[model samples]
Target: MGLIVQKYGGTSVGTVERIMRVADRIIEYKNAGNDMVVVVSAMGKSTDVLIEMARQIAPNPSAREMDMLLTTGEQVSIALLAMALQQKGYDAVSLTGWQAGIATESVHGKARIQEVDTARIRSELQRGRIVIVAGFQGISEKGEITTLGRGGSDTTAVALAGSLRADKCEIFTDVSGVYTADPRVVPMAQKLDSISYDEMLELAILGAGVLHPRSVEAAKKYKVKLVVRSSFSQEEGTCVEEAADMETGRVVSGVAHDEDIAKITVVGMPARVGTLSRLFNTLAGAQINVDIIIQSSYDAAVTNISFTVSSDDLVRTLDTLAAYQEALGFDKVEHESGLAKVSIVGAGMITNPGVAAEMFQQLAEQDISIKMVSTSDIKVSCVIPAEQTSLAVRTLHTAFGLDVAEQAVVHGI
Candidate 1:
């Protein structure tokens, strides 16, 4: 029998009823003669609640302690799911990240999976037990608990599937499948039947919430077959794999937007070979991820550099820059919140000309001012005001003909 790895997000196993429902689903898969490995996130909003508790205790708690506290959310999920399976008269076993042999780097809040020793998982499966693993967490070489950052459970499942060489890895979430754009923002967004790993990775990194970017990276690296679907329905899901030719079908695969963005500009900086490097190195040391960077030079001697970061990291980023402002010789540091990043992604864009021009033309026509811009072979991202995010998404969705027609249907199997 083939082995299948499935991951349920926080919302899928949010409540007692949902946990029981997930148990039933696992049982059904077992009856189909497949060895099952299930991974699950914490119950709905539990992680958030835990974070709130920590913040209440201390405004800036220790990252090591936070990791210790956050991993418990998935621990509760795994144990309860195991109990539900047993109540249904099925053999089941639950494993935490350490118990399942997931070894990670020592980074407390955002550890990366170093390797997965799957001997325990194999033993449990051989005993005719469904294996449920706590997602989003792992033990470090230092014997400390480390939690992967947000959406890390998705990475956990894909990494497990890769290590086990499972037949398929299914990601079950609240959304039915991957759409051309967020269905909440664009009602006409169509669900894709299938997508290339490159396109899906771009979408994930650009803010498509259906799957995690790290999971997509792992899947692509290991050639793992992935399916994304809704736990709430029986509908067929979107398959992610390598395509014969990425540019063969549609020119634009999807439009993704993130409203959780803030922009920072280092003004009146002397232009030098190491000035840019020094500025960014400081941010990297602070663990701030900079996106969509732009540099403008008014004269040969000085330049203005700007970049975007997640709004959550804005304060830390500013603080980091301020500490080094004198050393870096920057005159002033300015930042603005209430900004958004809008992006269009497709593998076909590599071969298609005018994709950027077309996107810019559409925004210009709508009087939506583009601030900073970044482009890769498959994607182009622009920073704009947060209030105009929905309008930009809708406008681009229609501009690229990504909007679904009335009575349109998604065909999948």
Candidate 2:
């Protein structure tokens, strides 16, 4: 029998009925003659509720205590899932991150997995028991409980699968698999059956949200085969692996868009070596992530640097730049919120000519202006007004033939 590791997201095990459904699925895998290990996120909305509760008590709760509190959500899930499986007549046992020997660094909010001691899991499996693990949380060397940050459960599952050397790591979420676009916005977007790790990484970063980027990175590094499937259905889902041949390549795999973006432009700066460094250093110090940077070389001894950051950082970023404006000798600092980033991700685009031209032509035909442009080996992204995001996404989806024969409908699980 081969060992298999499966991870269920918060929506997959959201309720008592859903937990029982998940238990039934695990039992089926066990009956199929494969050793099963399951990792689960907190029940649906539990983490958010806890966070809201903590906010109610204190505007800024201590990170250590917050970690201690949020980690309990997943603890509740694994324990309940184990009990459900046992009630269904399967040999099952649940273990928290500490009990399962997930050793992590001292970082409380975004702890990285140092190592996973698989002794207990192996022993339980050898005794013909299905092992359940609480995802997203680990214990430090000093016995302090720590939590991996948002989407940490995905990373936890991949790490466990790598350490256990499982045959496959399956991530069960609310959706069936990765799609060509956000189906809610583009109703005709189709789900992909397979995708390359590199393409998947671009999609995740571009807001596809099928799998977390960190999880995909770990899976790629460890050479673990990953499947993104729905917990409610048995249909085949998307498989992510290393690209083997050009035959599987598609011209445009998907279109991704992000609405939580703001643009900051340092305009008319005196052309100098240290100007860019000082500006970016200030932003870095404020813990703001700057994305899609474009700089114009100086002809009149003035350079313009434009970049995108999260909308929430707009105020602080502008303030920080203004604080250093006089010292940096910039003419002015301009900021705009309510901007969107639309990225077209595909592996075949690198060798295929006319892809960029086609995207630009389509946007132009629709009267959608491109504010900024960024390109990589496998993707091209453009910034546009937030109001035009849906139009751009739909236009690109149609231009690239990502639309399905039938319309797609969105429903919550």
Candidate 3:
């Protein structure tokens, strides 16, 4: 009805032909009488290729330079899409993240958006032109280029939608919509018609890959409606919003699995009152996101603390723990990188029992061993062997009755 923000991922605009198709799609939306602001990621594998090129030049390039180099990918995307739209006799313009007024902190490669100055975007919108903004990047207060980390394009789109007060934010991904499990892994995985913001946030943070957690956070905070669909098809996709009414009987909404996880254990720490606090605070100071933490007191005088972090942070986490060994008073620090986290999320799980038991039983039937376990009101995540990730996902997907009968939709409502 009013302004809408649309985002296309790398695969959606991978080539000139794809870019033309995307332009046509945008034109159709414009013809529908709605103002449009589009966000786009780099062409397929272009960002990875750039990273490889940078590593070829320097083994460990500076994060600041990486941001400068990586932002070019999205710029390429915006420029090409704008050119395609113009070639089709449509009024279109391209703007980089900073040109569109995206301001961020000075965190070189992984900056969070601080605020958006919408004057430039609003000005372009008033001229009846489709504005294509580079996604995943912005500028810092010190006039430095900064990139939002992985899946940042989704964050950019959602943030822009909130700032513009857009009617909806459409995320055009490779998948038709959010699924009960990864369809590639579980053939029976069903696409959801709608999901709550909190459920979607949990799935994204747990590695759903359809949307980013930060984007869902912004959507929930600003009450932005989100529609996730495929760029390649016109299939009706999923709507993510606040569930109007909480229903009973459905305990497990979806199963999420992540392979990019590593666990660090600080073993035999002095059983002091503030040992856990000091250990975690030290990791926090390093900006490492710890997930799925586990602690046990093996004896009266000693305790074991284990936590998971991104695989990229595993080395740094181990190094930090080793450096602070004396301060943390831990006898040994061990790290495991060959682990995966498999989780099931459902809002109904808070009031429903036996969900975790069923999940654990299914995994056990599949001969999967759980290494570390973490539970929230709505989620139960377990760390297991990375190799068994797919098996675990499939098992749990079927166990939770998430599979379809004749079609890919779950049986019944």
Candidate 4:
């Protein structure tokens, strides 16, 4: 029998009863003769509760301390899950990230894994025991506790599967599978049977949230197969692999939207050699991420550069830029909130023409004004008013022939 690694998100093991159910699923797999390794996130809303408590204790907590506190969330999941399996008469063991040999960079709250020592995991599997390891956390080379930022647990599972050379990796979440759009938003969003690594990576990065981009990157690097399925269902999940079926069906596989966007514009900047580099490097030094940048000629002598960042980062971004104002050689800056970004992603776009044009046309037809734009071989993103996000996504989804069954649905906007 093949070795398999599985990861259950917070919602999957949100309650003690759910943990027992997961244990049963694990037993079924083990009974089938496959070696099992399971990775799990903190239980539902526990991480948020922890963060809220930390905020109450101190408005601004140290990232190191935050990492220390946050890592415990997954520790709880692993231990409780292990107990559930053991109570069910299955031999199971729980290990934290460090005990499982997950090593990471020294960075706190956003560490990247450096290596995985499979000795302990392999030993457990050899004994016919199911191993439950904590996800989203690892010890730094300096022995500091660290986290992999948002969606780190997904990376943890995929990385372990790769290191173990497991036959496959399965990501069990609340949703049954990956969809063309968020099914909650676009009720007719189609579930993809299989998606290519490139397409899935784009969708994940574009804000699908079904799987994290880091996990997809690891899967691609190690050539590991990934399946995203429902934790509570027997339905087959979406397969993420080398090639997808997009070549035959829809030219646009999905429309993705992010409502946490905020826009910042550095006005009247001299269009000199080091202007762009200096400005962005400052943001990078501040660890602020920038997305969907556009530079325009405010005048020949000065250009206006605008970009987007998370609303949470908007204040930090502005403060960082203000600190470097003279160095960046910009006249003034402006900021705007209540913004969003929406995009269409598919591998077929690489060989297809006018996809971006069609997307812009779809948004235009909905009277949605595009503020900024970014395009790649497989995707195109536009920033627009947050209120129009749902309309934009549904409009583009239907326009791309992605929801043929809902062809008669009214354009509600």
Instruction: At residue 52, give the lDDT of candidate 4.
Output: 96
Pairs with backbone N, CA or C atoms under 3 Å apart (clashes), candidate 1: none
Q: Specify the poorest-scoring 10-residue window by lDDT in model 1.
A: 404-413
Please estimate how well model 1 matches the true structure, expressed as its whole-model Cα lDDT. Answer: 0.92
Question: Model 2: per-residue lDDT, tens digit, 1-413?
Answer: 68899999998898999999999999888889999989999999999999999999998688899999999999999999999998988889999998888999987776889999999989998999999999998999989999988788888889989999999999998778888998888989998888899999998888777687878988999999899988888878889988773245598899999898999889998887897888888888766679999889768698999999988678878888888888888889888888999999999898999899999999999999999999998899999999999999999999998888987544344
Cα error of candidate 4 at position 240, Å: 0.4
lDDT of prediction 4: 0.90
Ranking of all predicted structures according to TM-score, beginning with the best and ending with the worst: 3, 1, 4, 2
Q: How much does candidate 1 score in TM-score? A: 0.95
- Poorly placed runs, candidate 4 (over 4 Å): 244-247, 404-413
Q: What digit string (tens of lDDT, one per residue) describes model 1 on residues 175-212?
A: 77899998878878998889999999999988998898
Candidate 2, residue 310: how far the Cα is off, in Å: 2.7
Candidate 3 local distance difference test against the native: 0.90
Better of 3 and 4 by TM-score: 3
Alpha-carbon RMSD of each model: 2.5, 2.8, 3.0, 3.3
Q: Write the per-residue lDDT of candidate 3 for residues 1-413, one digit (tens) a residue.
A: 58999999999999898899999999999999999999999998899999999999998798888999999999999999999999999889999999999999989777899999999999999999999999999999999999999889999999999999999999998888999887777877888888888899999999898898999999999999899998988888999988664344568889999999998888998998898889999998877889988888988999999889999888778888889888888899888888899999999898888889988898898899999988899899999999999989988888888898634432101
Candidate number of the best lDDT: 1
TM-score-wise, the better of 1 and 4 is 1
| TM-scores for the candidates | 0.95, 0.89, 0.96, 0.95
